[model samples]
Target chain A: MIKPELLVTPTSVENVEEVIDAGADAVMIGEERYGLRLAGEFDRTAVHEAVKLAHERGVKVYVAMNALFHNDTLPELPDYLAFLDKIGADAVVFGDPAVLMNAKQYAPKVELHWNTETTATNWYTANYWGRKGSARAVLARELNMDSVIEIKENAEVAIEVQVHGMTCMFQSKRTLVGNYMEFQGKDLGVEGRSKDRTLVLHDPERDVKYPIWEDWNGTHIMSPKDMCIIDELDELIDAEIDSFKIDGVLKDGAYIRDMTGLYRQAIDQYAAKPEEYIEEKEAWRDRALALQPDNRELDTGFFFKETVY
Target chain B: MRTEVKETAAADKRVITKKPELLAPAGNLEKLKIAVHYGADAVFIGGRDFGLRSNADNFSIQEMEEAVEFADRYGAEIYVTTNIFAHNENMEGLDVYLREIEAAGVRGIIVADPMIIETCKRVAPTLEVHLSTQQSLSNWQAVQFWKDEGLDRVVLAREVGMNEMLEMKRNVDIEIETFIHGAMCISYSGRCTLSNHMTARDSNRGGCCQSCRWDYFLYEDREDANAESGNALFAEEDAPFAMSPKDLNLVQSIPKLVDAGIDSLKVEGRMKSIHYVATVVSVYRKVIDAYCADPDNFTIDPEWLKELEKCANRPTAPAFFENTPGYEEQMFRNHKQKTPFDFSGLVLDYDADTGMVTLQQRNHFRPGDTVEFFGPEIERFSMTVGTIWDDEGNEIDAARHPLQVVTFKTDQPVYVHNMMRKEL
Candidate 1:
């Protein structure tokens, strides 16, 4: 069971079935109303349909409503949660304390999963949130496996770790694109190249490029490569991590299917013959590489970093 | 020690709003003292461990004790930051560190990690906890939630607009704190990982190399069939939007901030100089006092903006307080910082008998040069640099070298640490 319940990011309702069929045990959806990945979220009807499809296949559906909200907007949350409750969302993933507190009050029946953006970098936070009635917490992707194992050893709450994804290095509420384009004498998310998602960024001295995108809300400076830890499944299993999540909510169903299929095969192969996992590692890597999206490059992410400092 | 722990509830729904405390950043002990001297009601600082400002000359335990005593004399509060998003390795000494600072008479602790907040409840139960801007508490519910969790104050996110802050005051009865001045983070405070990825320096844990402020340019994606490896690499020279944001100056908005029931106005600079600490603190202090005294007749003193401009390293912008800052306000072309004002000297002890004030020159100055001596009490007083005595008590025409201690005859008395800036 520690091999991780393969989780897939199903951005739209139409992709839910593909994600499940591709062998994902769970589906994470970003609702259009809340959460960070607003560009890749499902509307009310879409999320309801997605949740229904996942549930029919015995796959869990987690709704991402992690957007930081103000008091004026918080009053409307209970109604949204009630809608999620009616649709039977397996869990509500969020990143704000108010969201956690409000979810407890309004939608107690819906399992609350605190996203890592809440700064759950240590065991204490997970256990603290567990005590506060949150069902699970996502471990910060910043933490390496050594730290992850240490957290899992002491934490009371069930924890999920991102095994593969487009890691966001920076996300801000300030719409830098919109504001910058206005300076360029253009509109934000409108007109020319300002709206284009391929606006790559480079470190002042470093020649390497990182992808950047801006929407109505804000900007995200993402990693140039997607994080792929298919080879590190053994380490996560050894750490007893609750789930392995693959992030790319804005990606299409084919992306979800390919990623989900690779992880599914990796998990199964490791399960059947644990000793052969290491020897077959490169073989599995090749299999995943064959299915890897042309736009994305893959690396181990923070899995091998050993230490944060 | 005065804690900011007002009960988050009152009979009238609004918490008994005191005049918002003028909080300043203290990179080190000198800066801490300068902040208090310049009319800061409370000062937030980082210790050598667990604080986010890795580059700053952070306080040691000995310095924390001294700083707490210094702040206490002026009836001001001291908040220590141990706000790192701790990994398993960083958590071991955290309780002991918290207890040590608490024993040092720190009035409060600013923390972003909830585990640290929970730890504070257990380890230093008497001390107040201020939720750092890193927590990104944008709404009143978030403020209320932290208050419910036993936090004394919530430093709301910079992205939070004026209306939201005001709404938080009306609904959320916590001590709401916001950055009224200083640097604006391009990413949500404490949420950035650009430094971590680019330099292996964790932004949350402190080694933020400030990758957001780095220069960058955009290029379109490569064509799928013959995708070149390096074509997306610098299709242009500079990004129109990706430059570091200008430093935030909210001194003009003090009246409106006060009207919105803010409990504290914080200036964000721990890695700043003592001169910067003094000038910024003094300006905000004056603005806060002026507004509180005559809220109805309040008008932004034009001189305050001029004073802020002199102190600032980057162009000043109002941030999201008025609205989302426009391109004109947020974006900058040249990323390098500029120092237009010369902080020439620090005011040393004054000798009434000889009518001479002892001073240490930070920058060079000439004999008979008019230098402005400004501090908490004295806003602006120009005095001619008369006969200057060197460190060995030799009279010289000019204080020719930086950091040279010189004594000069003065008609008006000057307080210690009063900045002497010769306009450059």
Candidate 2:
């Protein structure tokens, strides 16, 4: 009886067959990484193609337009919003208030999700976004388990959290890497020698180097660690969260198959024999951790207590 | 050549002069010395109170005095940060802190609040005020607004790119200082509430708990929901900490920065270690000096780059120098690998004639482990430990005691000023 949602990266899509084979309830498709540089024109044809493919198999497709848009770029919103509506995108992820306001007028039928970049730290912001128009609010990456619980308890809208993929090292949307890039006369979106731009922080005590690369858009660096929450299924479910979102734009089909397969098994096993599910949970945790990047440290985050600065 | 590319290749290249000042961070007096020694034209520091980093071993009055003297000796400027967002209670010690800073002969005070700026103007007029990035100066309007308020300098918001910077530079007359390197805030400028909302600690006021770095899960269904619908689900994913990219490094881009006519290149990490100050300042100094000496011949030394790599870092990217990409572009897929080396020991004394280097064993080191000697202006040597003598001069296979003075012979002469460390 447990409802499960998978936030599939459109980039994770191999074809309509792969999505149908995975049997996911819904799919979130947009740019691999969301931002002004990468959030180019929302591919209407792709959206139409995805929606047609997903609908043919009874799966819903959500379009991601989740990047902070400046006031200067406000005039271009209506067209993008209308495009989503015309294409019949199941939903659209948005971070900017202006975009939301415009989306309300232009594409009222589409479900709206508050992107994580809005940095909705508390229930007030979450509730506010929900009230304003967002059907679901993507919680900030900084939220601990307790805070997430508090948000779920307090939020009026559905709460979606990033379940997997590379976590961001900076705040969503607002970053200086793009500003730095614009200064250097290089377009971040284009793939070229622009990849060589490197940000390094010196850790003198450890005597080691930390390097942060600019994304294709040049706004912010991608996080080194991927979020894997397969282990704490019981704890998360107990918190009454609404949806589980996975972030894998560049991942292969096996990733989706393996991850979805494991989660499906865990949810089923947990429901079948609650006590016996502990072993299944451990096995799933091992699998999830094995899929993560090498030598990466993992933490329970804010779920236990507030992390140190 | 491509058809479109060949046509516009003859665009005019404008020449620029008036190089920006180099502003460095000093965590303490030792770091201050290293920064100045390594070629920081101006250095910024925080005091124990009224500064953002409460955890930093900030400057005491005596240390401040020494720092001022050191800057004066090196013909450099020292700017003290009084930039913390002031609450009602924080205001009680403000007058005293300001008076003490003025007495310390600081060149300027970096502040964010308008009330503090006004107060500084009234009380400590001699101390120039540089607006902190917390004020969020992104446009000519904001720059003009701050300049109208009598500010001498403004630290532009980190969200601004170089194109906007150049545009603002063209419009605003006030001195512009931007963060060239170090830890970046995930939030805009410094206006983050993730810490305050998640915990009681306020990030805007600078007491951040850094709740962003924790792992997260994407749940599909409500935990208490009925299983029949197949719509509700719980999925878990581990999220990274702080949502902030690693600090900025523009060492290789010094020439471009100089050409931009920026007023200052600011290095972040006021809470960093002395070694960080030395390593960063030394490398930057070499790069800047090389460029100043001959712009065309300027080349980043391979050794300096290696030394920088020796410090903890993920993959490096030029932050917002060219364009603004999103989180995916900025995210590092790999965490910095902890060096296999441990700072096992330091040389306490050296007898040049005897060819013996006396050292205190800080950590356990095997005889086979490779050791690196860190010395000023010298290439770091990779040497293997050959023979070891314990503190009592007894022949020993290894030294493992804390503060255990050990001696070993080197192929070449080593100095007491240099420290020896080995990789595990």
Candidate 3:
């Protein structure tokens, strides 16, 4: 059976049912994309609510706590993990080893997914997380298709790839703006417009002068790009991948509908006529391409191998 | 009464002591002029290449030269942005871009890439290199990491709250520049892939079509697709909040920002209008000067605060400063309508004795519309549609055309520099 997973931000819950209904096997929930921590803790109530609803429909729910763990906040992980366990999260996604270990220790029953934030580009990191008992891993966004195939071939655990979404401009969760705004006495996580705030430097080449009040988490590093892998599903599935994931928790339902529908059709076409599906694959590619975000260029995301450039 | 005044005076103590550099954004030459004229201590702009904002009206080489000269004439610093996340293809432009920017007498180059930093150091050794926020320098180790790489100043990440910044400052020696106002990103510093994954435009490479503004939903069962192929948006009750908060405004908290030991106070708009540049710069300039003039006697004028509200803004809140519980301050539905007032013209002459305010109209203004006068302070008062007299005292229901100088008598004194606006 072709099981498709959509990586969703909690903000994209509006389209979650639609994604699942469109034949997505599961949904991954993450923090708001803007980096503002609206809730003090992971909105467990929302998670439980989504889980109950999804389970009723035969879909699984995954919670993404994929941000880099601060050293100062490490002490709180056990409690947070325990809370995640208490909330009956089907699985947890994280970056830091400490957080992963803590989640494994405190919430042994809850499956853990290694987030791409850890930069798991090879089998070694994937194997390490698998050995540490991770059930799945959301591989790095930079990994090409070949690297994904290789990692899947060697990985001991399930492998997840970001089929779509913005790629972070930075290496990991290192943020000068987050630290700077905090230093200025502005709590970056607060949910309101404050007199004390952070500024995103758009056009950093120009003298920084414009004051953008929105997205105070620092300008978003990238925009959303739809992942159209409908044609590549057979190739990915042949690589022994555990899950085909869609990235974006804040995207619209129409995006969810069009993307999931095309993938579902491609998977069904591949299953029915393996050789004949090549032409169907081209059709799926066209369908995926048609869903592109505002006419942006498309790439296979190093899906073939490690990016050389 | 004396005791009450004393208490009020005591409450007005300075929040911060350091004189933070006011950094502004310049999309083009005109914005650069407005920023400098208003009060920017330094301005940052994108060059024609290697900057993230490819869409902005980036400066040409000659414009950069002119902008540097213009800023220098006013004693303001100019920083060129070379912060795009470069692949090999983009590296070729770095050497020439750096050399030319440095040659133009630019003060610094804000960058995020390590290779670019190395290139800038070799090509323009004298130019200061500030670490861009895209680098995401959250901890002291990372701060020192960039410093060791020869970063002269570091713009810290937005996800860090003030307490963490202080901790980082205690551990690092690098100059700290923090954003005091502007748009906030939904992703952590520059670590988002939401855009590039959905659109092939890599936001790090700087073409971002904000996908975050779109609405989202959480589906319970995948079958909602069969229910209604067209109507499928669903959201869980506790999902992340939609829409980014309006840009940060720290005008009233300038003293506290200075106290935070921030080396520079950066403003965030690049695609904004000239009026935005002038208004924001002048307000911050006045607030900064007021603090510097006499810390003991400084108080933000209520009138100045009202004037600040006239600029395009959502509801204002002091983000995270007081550590209040509730997200109300950051949540804005949307702007109600375009600002009700359109800037009409400036007052050319005013006579306090006759209470006559004379001006050239940028747009036709009808009688009975409330007019807002903006200068050192913003004052709004209603006007009755009395007989309007032209420059020659011709009675008319409205000032019919552009540049038509009209005179009206009002009780308040109108300054020559005052800008007038009429409600739409």
lDDT, residue B318, model 1: 82
Best by TM-score: 1
Of 1 and 3, the candidate ranking higher by lDDT: 1
Q: Highest lDDT among the candidates is held by which one?
A: 1
Question: What TM value does model 3 have?
Answer: 0.58
In candidate 1, position B56 carries an lDDT of 87
Residue lDDT tens for model 3, A1-309? 454454444344546667777877787764433123221123556666777777888888777665554436656668767876886778887654455667767988889887644235456546656766788867766556766777777778888876654344322132333333332355657623221232222221221111113232333233223334557777776665777666543335687666776666676666677777786666767767777654343556545532221
Q: After superposition, how far is residue A19 of candidate 2 from its true place, in Å?
A: 45
Give Cα-based local distance difference scores for all models.
Answer: 0.78, 0.63, 0.62
Candidate 2 lDDT tens digits, A179-268? 433334446575222224333322233322223344433334334235567677666666667677665533455666566556656656
Deviation of model 3 at A213, angstroms: 25
Would you give me the overall lDDT of model 3? 0.62
The residue ranges of model 3 lying beyond 4 angstroms of the native Cα positions read A1-66, A69-71, A74-309, B1-18, B221-241, B320-326, B330-337, B346-420
Tens-digit lDDT string for candidate 1 (B1-424): 1223234353534332358888999999988888898899999999989998888889998999999998989999999998888887788888899899989999999998888888888998989999988887788777777878888888888888888887778776778889988887777887788777777878888877776776565555543412234544223453533658888887777877877768888999998888888888888888777766555567888998888878777888788886766677665567656788899999888877777888988999988788888876565888777778887889888887877888888767777777889887
| Clashing pairs counted in every model | 2, 97, 118
Which fraction of the native contacts appears in each prediction? Answer: 0.65, 0.05, 0.05
For candidate 2, please provide the TM-score of chain A on its own.
0.79
Interface RMSD of each: 3.2, 12.9, 11.9
